[model samples]
Target chain A: MDLVNALVVFANFVLIPATAYGAQLALGALGVTLIYGILRFSNFAHGDTMAFGTMVTILCTWGLQALGVSFGPLPTALLALPIGIAATAALVLGTDRIVYRFYRRQKAQPTILVIVSLGVMFVMNGIVRLIIGVNDQNFSDGERFVITAREFKAATGLAEGLAIKTTQAVTVVAAIVVVAALFWFLQRTRTGKSMRAFSDNEDLALLSGINPDRVVQITWILAAALAAIAGVLYGLDKSFKPFTYFQLLLPIFAAAIVGGLGSPLGAIAGGFIIAFSEVFVTYAWKKVLGYALPDAWAPDTLVQLLSTDYKFAVSFTILIVVLLFMPTGLFRGKS
Target chain B: MNMRNLMLFAGVAILFVLTGILQSWNLSLSILNMALLSAIMALGVNIQWGYAGLFNTGVMGFTALGGLAVVLVAAQPVPEAWRAGGPGVLLALLVGAGVLAAAIALHKRMPRGRMRTITLLVVLTGGFFLFRALFDPNAEAIEAVNPATSGYMGGLGLPSLWAWPVGGVLAAAAAWGIGKTALGLRSDYLAIATLGIAEIIISVLKNEDWLARGVKNVISLPRPWPVPYEVDLQQDPRFLQVAAEWGFDPVTGSSILVKLLYGGLFVAVLLALIWLSERALNAPWGRMMRAIRDNEVAASAMGKDVTGRHLQVFVIGSAVIGIAGAMMTSMDTQLIPGTYNPLRFTFLVWVMVIVGGSGNNWGAVLGGLLVGWLWLIVESLGPIVMSGVTASMADGPLKAHLVDSAQHMRLLTLGIVLLLVLRFSPRGLIPEK
Candidate 1:
């Protein structure tokens, strides 16, 4: 009956979820944008590569769990994540050298590279499935919540309780830290500038005496590391399943495209836009509406803009609209 | 193109003969038919990538749509279910069409810029609500009647094979729509768009349970061929006689017969498509497509309608894939939406296209059969290959380890095959002119 209490609950549930989701998409979009910049193709396998990286981390998490190691306040998966990043970095570098190198040398079309990545996608998918059967595996081994709903209600003395799960907090923090590091590395580091230079113009970069192989190697490593972090964080926030990663392709790609394909900052912005839109648009704001507006003004209907299931549809529609209006993405790629 | 062509045909025949010797004639024949369908699909890809040099990562979506065509055109209808879903869907479609038309008209008629965009958003959003409001009740009623099996509108009561051409038509139509807008963009744009379209198609198929039974799956679909529900092959003397001659059982003989029937149908379609593709390749149109593909700017300067030609090839190629999907659906006598995954239909088809040779129809056909057979045989073959390699593990748990490893070899083999092919012969087994 209390309007203020309802509004608070709404913010805690809807806004926080959207914010956390936005963080995940932003990180994932950064990974995708990085690869598209240097690799010159939209990798169809990026999602699964993320999955593969997470699977490695999950394995390590289980091993640590078996060894009775605990992060206490944090999920042990957090502890295992760096190791996963290293392993994923190795795998991505190997793929670049072994599979992608030949095509790069031949100067094959970007479309051809995309198809080749599809092949790599299938192989990676099969391997990931083989390693962890096609089922959702939870590896978060920390306390359930930063504040349980009961605890929140008792402290606030309000009808609405704000319960933040440990995993969500970790996901948000990790994403911010990783993204901050990525931007710093991309802008300030020698190798990072080299990647930007190459993405801007290959011939010019080569003329400037930048090593192409070195740039590519660095790009792959960075992309892999980003993918690993994104995958681990998303898996931690939700749950990790091979198929979920495959399905996550839509949202991740949506973020990348909306941000403009080659721009990292754009990718981050695009990801938040998409994630928030998907969350807010599908969110049943009836509860919040009841509180926000006076009794006469409160809507009788669910007032949800779209069903939750149509979340992907919204993302896709946004992408299509953006592509139609601005093919270079919302923020045009750096000239 | 003469002697070598004949030798290639003879080489294929010899391969078939080897299949005859090693596997059952029926099993070999059955695989041949599926392989033929795969080839047809690959040829569709070839026309786009090889001739027009356009990329389409949504082959699976088009194929599934083709399967939908077959179901719509052929399967027997349940009148109640039909009436329930049919009218509601028609209404939904009309409203959707109206919305799209209004959006487009607004785009044209209104002052260009934000005003037009706002008009579109308002109209589209209103239409979506209107469509959903009208759709929900009818869908609920129809689904309620037949909760499990016949949840949606039944198909037109006709021969399911009619679905093949219809599937082609449907796929081509979608291609035209997508290619017209997206094909003009860069390769990466096209890939992303196509991939999105594919996912949308899948989502529709999955959620629109009233249409293709959604994720629940439509099993025991009416087959163009016989279902063989008659006398168990064990009791059939004719099958026994054939089995004895072939060093097989009556059951095997029957399977072979059905497989051969399927194989013949698939090959006929494959040959026809291959012939059509080759003819197109040789035609002036094909040369222009190539010209446009190789250098868009040059071709455009030369007054070639590069985008138009690309749209044509993309549509035609997708139509072929759709037809092939219809054929596969017919072969299985089932339309399982869940079964037709992107990794298989979409990505695998791309592999077939790339490995075969992008522009070469023959290369695509060869690659399809090669990969198709490899995909099927690798499971059994992996163990044998591993057994020979792991003979040194006699003292350890190495044999079991090798066998376990073999289970995962199929994907590894697919990956290795693609990598090796791209590195060595990027053009494929049969390079086009």
Candidate 2:
């Protein structure tokens, strides 16, 4: 075994997992940033929103699976994704109309909106739990791998083997496609520019004859789509659990804040940054290092700085440290 | 303030009576005591939010510390277990402290940018392992004493009553630390920072099995009131006469007697704190705090240090929450760390404060009492609501299924109630002007 062989093995496992995770996080962060920009407060319900979306997707996937509707070498959830996104978007828009619109009319403070989001979070959580119970549901269905680890090792005749799963590749491709769509929607469209103009200066935009309600509506649709996409990706990668999705709220918020809240690109960059750092810092490098190092120099310990269980701590620590240094975040968020 | 106080007092009195009529007296009294504690907590929140307009979202952390205080000060000591591995544990603790100190010192001494980051990171990494090596072994020895019963070092063996005050102090110290770091930042920053710190505190409590026993839980904690042993007095002829006079069964009479005794003690503490806090809020310092909150820039321009005033109030308010925390642990007679989730203790408390008038102490107290009663009843009535709804439906498979699902309606109800309140009245029943 040599360094090059170890690198190949590392790429197959850790890098692939991290990249898939980073893309999912970036999607989640983009949703959060959109809400913070337009609504003007962190949406505590984002996690539950993801759960609600995933719950629909899972149900649809199950229905499709029972009907024998599935793509070969890909999850049946792929067919159910659009249905999930549409349903989720409708639910969110409805919630905005009933719960948030009243307070918006009262001209309530943003903090009040933040508190209202907590209430929404609880409701959404209950709804998801009510429908799916709290148990984790593994709905993944795809080819196990492009090449099994055993086959790869046998074929390469190397000590380190490689296996690339179909789901992982699909996750990365879907993320890139969705992100591209979102960027195109936001940058190349008239409504997208109007939304940005509104978030940047609402008073000026209103004076500029841009319809406030129209801009706000478009923002929610975009946010809901992003959230649904992110939720589906996360549920695909990990199993779908309502509480776990809620727990993801902290990290999602961390990514948004780290990237600079209100900046879509910043959210994406921040998500990847948080995901990669968390994976890297907590990972034990012993296996890869053992293959690379000289026989005498190989160490016994894991050689990790932090434990994997402290992933939340890593995100929070990075957030606090970054906030201490740069309050505006990486991309310098909107005024 | 007087009109608000009168209205609040009337509201609480009515709530107490309504709860007694609707539910049982025992449940009402239980909620009453908690309401009083919630009032204290709200007062703490009011000091920060009402006086200084500073939001401290880490109420759960300081409250948990108060629970820890009960364990530290009131729980009986396990002398044998302490003797076996207590010194080792002590040494491990010292090592842990040394690690933190070294991390801070390294941060200061190292040059800026990459050098500082690298130095701090290296020290932290090394320190983590060194302390873990020391702690894990000692913890194993201590836990080996009696893994099923009393496996670790116990408390100070003081009266349980002392735990309440000690909780306040611990909470205050925690508040001081958090405030020093976060109070100077913007409000939103403070919110996120506080949220992060609260999670960290909960994580520590959940994982530190040696201290809180993590999910294992500590139970049967002693209290400062009369013991149930007094129930045996009913066998006496004289006690029988008393029970007859009360026109109740011996068991009912004795339980109620004990509960009333606890109630009196709790009420006294609650009232004393309320009165003291009220006085403080009306004093010159209180007026200055209000002034600072209204216009921080103007306050600072006029030579009043708004930040410092905010810190002072933040610490005091958090300490009050700590007192409530100790009271809760004592009442439950258990320190179950896993139960301290954000939704229950933290967000619920936020709802109480916001719904209670944010700036008014009386409003807080009233809101606490009303909400606490509502919380208890909501849990009980949630199932009933579901049953009634489902019962009216046609007797089919769907009806049977919905009835079974009724068991999980409380969470939905709670969420709906919160949304309704936020929509109709964000300032609570009485707006704190």
Candidate 3:
């Protein structure tokens, strides 16, 4: 069926890839939102934090591969993720103690904190580059694809085939697990409740004997863990490059803000929105149209709204639009 | 000036002199020129952040636009490319502008209803397709004209110096648009918006080949007037005689002379800007801006136009950055869009402003010269330093990596310096009096 073929083409190009990308963005946004909620700053260093986590994970993955260890059907990166998260947590905790604690003690303005984070970003960026160099490193060494295009075509007897990469599947699954655990921790746990209370009213929470330092520490650790998992999953899905992770800051910020900064549910929604918009705008829909349309009615041109190069522009435009209409964001987390 | 300020400036001068004594005068002069430019950039940022407390992270974008201005205003025209598709491209741009204007007008005039939304979408979609149809074909034709060199519609072949102000105007226009949209929002929002806009501006520069030949680069741009080429100076008999009298080789004399001329011009510009900025800072308007920055709510209560002042300062600052960017491109004699990155253009300038002393004009100049000199010195010294550190180590991949990654040491050092200053002094080298 031509319609089935069209649907398959749409799923392959737009739906599946966007979902995977959205999951990565959601994980990234979750980290950013958590920081904004608890730390009370946007954390300009978040992208570099992700890069640092990914760098540690990558080094661990390489070490594992050298030791003849792998996850078999999944990437070896999965086995190395926990070590990455732990290392990232340590790094972030150290950074807070050294650089951010002074500012926190000063009770500096959020804008000042943002500038301080820029300094941290530079240092983290340097560390990543020094360790891994500026070149792309591919660490996805196990199964390449869950469903090969040829196999899909043979099974479906359709003109278009739907192929899903193993990384994409893993990204979606890992993201769901992470999000569920995070929600559960936030909703049910005492530390999570304390964090929520602190975020809600810092003075009131302090008055209620909630340890501000502990809340801050837990926030950093959770944020670091999320950043590490997101970074490793993203690196697996695409490729590990420090500059690309740095660039991802724009979209991640866009996602966090659009979802309403400091709102977990909003962050996930914002990520999907940004991812879908970027993919839909940049994707050439000529083939899908050709499959669905009557023979003579098929369009002549590639129906891409914008070039792939302008994908950053798409996310930026969405951010600007959201900022213009809803300064507090979709879920009204904070102004 | 105070004794401390005088000593700081003297220290910067000594550093340059040391560079001249230790390295070649040519290298020292080159560094001086870049430092002068960096000072201008720092002063621009100081105007926004110091005077108005606006956090603009799009300095790279404004600087890149300034570079674009040089190519658009000074480069030799590619007649064939223009003849191929120039008019169509212009028309397409006009149509696009008209569409946006119409949409704005419709939004203002139309009542809030579904009909308005439908009409707006219809107009936008139709205009986009029409614009694309015209733009794509013409751009392709222009790009096809030579495809090797001169594949883009080039400039008016004006004097290169003219591009400096044109660059300011271009950047000012962009800043106006951005400030109009993003000003009056939360401070961090402005920072994020500016960051995103900077990236978009760079992507435009990289992809729009029909404008400036994209990544292929536009080379051999005419130098600003009165700075003669070294070869021309070398060929002059009087110059050669003068060089001989000075006990210098003609080639070396000419190169040094060219750099000196450039340095003189740059110093003139820097002095003029410093004078102007100092005057402005002492003016009543400057007092009002500082007052507004210290407490926006209070300033608003006093009937000051907070957003308007911010937008004004943002534009002025961006214009200054744009001028510096144009000067840089003219000095380089080429426009390489790929080389424009935030680390070099944006955050580095922020460091200079912060390190120099935010609210003081002289402090910015000091910060610029010191940081610029330190940046270059660190770059040259990094490999040597790394090699020295690794000299006692065994020959292995670790040693090799340490040596190879020495270039990245500058970033780490810069970050450390920023953190140290922020933690210790917070007000930078020369605190605001």
Candidate 4:
């Protein structure tokens, strides 16, 4: 096989999946970091929120499909995403009003708020599971792959074939658009600037006549939107399962922390870093290495650093390393 | 100890009695036994969160370690598997430890430059491969012994009761390591770090098949009590008379007796822990911990090693959880690694501690019993309520689906309970004195 073919194979297996996963994580991390910045607590319910949103989107997608609605080349889930975001935003805002507002008024410790979020996590997790039983749900209804492995192999006349899923491409593009919108809002828009001000210095922002509650409401709304998008993208790419989303909490938190808890840029950077590291470490690279190296240097084993089962371990390790060296994360935040 | 505490405890007793009346005593006793263990876990969490104000979200990890302890200390050893590669496994473990030590030493000794980094990486990279080379084959050989049942190298062939305290010790050791790295961070970071560590511990437990049989599970763990089995109790002369007097058959009576015996053991352990915790809480050390928790800056200014205190409490609390975990395994008579989820093992305990009372030992126990009982009751009640609600609906897939979805109501109820408690009684039911 040609070097181009080998590179394509490696990219297909490792790079593409990681990029898609990274985008999903980045969006999730952004929501996490935003909450951390504004709310002054690590929202433990983030994963569950994602799951809840995804569950809503799936339900909506099913409803739409039942009504004979389709997105042609794109997944029907994409059409249902905005509705999902709206439902999620309402859910989050309602939770904040009922559960979190009391704590905020009490001026309770961040730990207490964290505990409250855990409560929210349970509620959201339960609601998601209740609405859509705890089995995997596939909602993607479109072309499965942008380029199939067989088609690529036929075109390239190579032994190795490269396949890219449509969902993966959608995830990356949606993530970019979301990140761009978020940054522009934060830097160039009125509400976004007010949020940054509040995040930077809550008291000063309050003194400047910024409605703290308004900023908080907007933050939750934005976070809910991001969480919904990320959740749907992930569900489209991989099957949607409630427990898997809960498990995603660790890696998402890792990404947010490694990027710096309240820094958007850091969260994005950390997401890619965590995703790539997890993918690369667990990946068996022997085939790609064999193709890249000379015939004399072809390896016998899989040449994997760690098994795929230890993917969580990879993210944990990276998180610990980051926490040890740069506790503020790669990008600085209030902490 | 006081009248209010007594009343609160009486309330719990009334609930238990209600459960016994509504359900069978056997089921109630099972709930009680689990509540007793959960109280121990809540006590552990209380020690950390209440006494030291440390946010530890890694209860599942410590609990898993406790489970691991059972497997290591009690299970019947697979001699053939051990003989096949036991030394190799031991040597591999040693190499791994040595590599870590050497790398740390090299980093500290060598100048903070590229040479030091390169040397450390080289040592680590080479050691990992070497260790794996030695470990993987032995692990495969050990796992290959009896793939269906005892593929893993079993425990030390000791009485399983020994595993309880040993589990505590093992968990304490893990906690100490975790605390060393994590205790210095902010509360949120510490929470995330502990969570990550817990995940790592679980991954190890689930993936390392040679050690604990992984997902295949290690069943028939030895119990501390010598209570007769249901069948044997039916044959027993004394038990038959007792069962006859109680107006019950042998099987049910025997099961209740076994559960009661286990409950007795658990109660003894719980009392001992509470006594120790109470003593500690009232003493100068406990006061110091509360002082540190309340105002770390002032405590540190007064020359207290804040992180050290946090670490101490963290280890002690985790050890208590570890003991409870081991006890839980003994109760189940099996070590199922897959069953340890954060929602069940970790967060539920937090709710227990919080709903019980954060700083009070009695509050934790009361909360544990209350939440544990509710958790069980809600699970059963959800379907009943759902069926009742959906009864009016026509018999179709929609109605059937609604009834099926009711199982999830337990978690929602738990969340609502926790939120309500936090909202109305921020100090919990049995507030700290």
lDDT digits (tens) for residues A1-335 of candidate 2: 48887697678757988888888889899999998888787788888889988899999999999998888888888889889889888988999999888877778776667878888888888788778777889998967677777898999888777887777777799989989988887789988888888889888988999987777777778778788878888887778888789778777888888899999999989998888888888888888888788878887877675657667777888888777678778999842
Give the 10-residue window scoring lowest on summed lDDT in candidate 4 chain B: B222-231
Model 3, backbone clash pairs (residues 3+ apart or across chains), number: 0
The segments of candidate 3 whose C-alpha lies over 4 angstroms from its true place after superposition are none
Supply the TM-score of chain A against the true chain A for every candidate structure.
0.97, 0.96, 0.99, 0.98
Name the TM-score of candidate 2: 0.90
| Candidate 2 regions with alpha-carbon error over 4 angstroms | A1-13, A102-107, A144-148, A157-166, A281-309, B1-15, B18-23, B80-85, B98-118, B225-241, B392-401, B404-408
Query: After superposition on all CA atoms, how large is the RMSD of candidate 3?
Result: 1.2
Fnat for model 4? 0.77
What root-mean-square deviation over C-alphas does model 2 reach? 3.2
- Evaluated at residue A221, the lDDT of candidate 2 is 81
lDDT, candidate 2, B259-328, per-residue tens: 6777787778778877887788789988888888877788899899987888898888888889989988
In angstroms, give how far residue B325 of model 2 lies from its true place.
1.5
True-contact fraction per candidate equals: 0.36, 0.35, 0.70, 0.77
Candidate 3, residues B1-433, lDDT tens digits: the string is: 7998999999999999999998888889989899999999998999999999999999999999999999999999999998999999999999999998998899889998999989999998899999999999999999999898789999999999999999999999999988988899889889999999999999998999999988999999999998999989989999989988889999888888988988898889889998898889899999999999999999999999999999999999999999999999999989999999899899999999889898888888899999999998878778898999999999999999999999988888788888888888789898776
Q: Give the range of the ten consecutive residues with the poorest summed lDDT in model 3 chain B.
A: B424-433
Give the lowest summed-lDDT range of ten residues in model 2 chain B: B225-234
Looking at model 1 chain B, report the run of 10 residues with the lowest lDDT sum. B225-234
Candidate 2 clash pair list: none
Q: Tens digit of lDDT per residue, candidate 3, span A1-335?
A: 27888999999999999999999999999999999999899998999999999999999999999999989899999999999999999999999999999999999999889989999998999999998999999989898999999999999788778899999999999999999999999999999999999999999999999999999999999999999999999999999999899899999999999999999999999999999999999999999999999989999999888989999999999999898778889998788
Complex DockQ per candidate: 0.47, 0.49, 0.83, 0.80
